[model samples]
Target: MELDDVDWKLLDLLQHDGRMTFTELAKRVSLSAPATTERVRRLEQAGIVTGYAAVVDPQRLGLPIEAIVRVKVRSLDTPRFRERVVALALVRDADHVTGDDCWLLRVVCRSMVELERFVEQAQRYGDTTTSLVFSSHVRNRPLTRAVVEGTAVD
Candidate 1:
């Protein structure tokens, strides 16, 4: 909700390292451990801090092939397509985007053959275009107050 400078600092610190203990977080934000815990709990209750997760490397897990698959779903197949996409294990992320593509999917596979199979399955719903991801400059950058307030500059 109404976050002060201390809250913002706590958010920044937590985003960088979610595993940081309450004592460490309190020290960084200049608050007591109990205060820091209370603030973090409030943030969670307010839905500002959604969840904590570990970021893993796809390549290290044997799913090196990454692809962006854009699909323009057929009018009648929209519901079915959405359901099917969710069940797809290879789809790491899916966005219902505007413009030419109805759905943009971030898919990862073990090899080109697996990717091709995924494309074939997607084609049943509508026209599909797939592109392999060569590199990613920004994967998951932490959000800060400046960025959220539109005051951040590159």
Candidate 2:
């Protein structure tokens, strides 16, 4: 489905504030509330707007230490390794990756002691290379002008 200028604006606005009301959204896009609502529904149906979620700060919630864990698993242990990773509550994100690491995990813990415990359990699955994240310089970037131009994101 081809998206128009209003559709692009709607997407951009929604990305910034998912909780914005349909009336507010319609005002920003200069459309009737019903029209904006229908457009949003269409976007959802097309899998463009997958889901709305509130972004939370893990550090503020007590999970201050963020670690990037690179895991290299044995071929025979892949299934068990995945199950173990998924079962860990501290694991915020896990990616099945190429190269030396079979999986890359983003883990957050309350302290060094907590991180050490998690790593001890994680090592059972594979050889692990872990790095502590000092800070995030760039994250959750906004949609680019390409979307407004009706071009695919690079």
Tens-place lDDT digits, model 1, residues 75-107: 799889988874688899999889998999999
Clashing pairs in 2: none
Global fold similarity of model 2 (TM-score): 0.90
Once fitted onto the true fold, the runs of candidate 2 whose alpha carbons sit more than 4 angstroms away are 145-154
Count of clashes in candidate 2: 0
lDDT of all the models against the reference?
A: 0.92, 0.88
lDDT tens readout by residue for model 2, 1-154: 8988898899899989999999999999999999999999999999988999989999899888999988888888888877877468999888889999888989999999998887887788779999999999977766755855677555
Error in Å for residue 100 of model 1: 0.5
- TM-score against truth, every candidate: 0.96, 0.90
Predicted structure with the largest lDDT when compared to the true one: 1
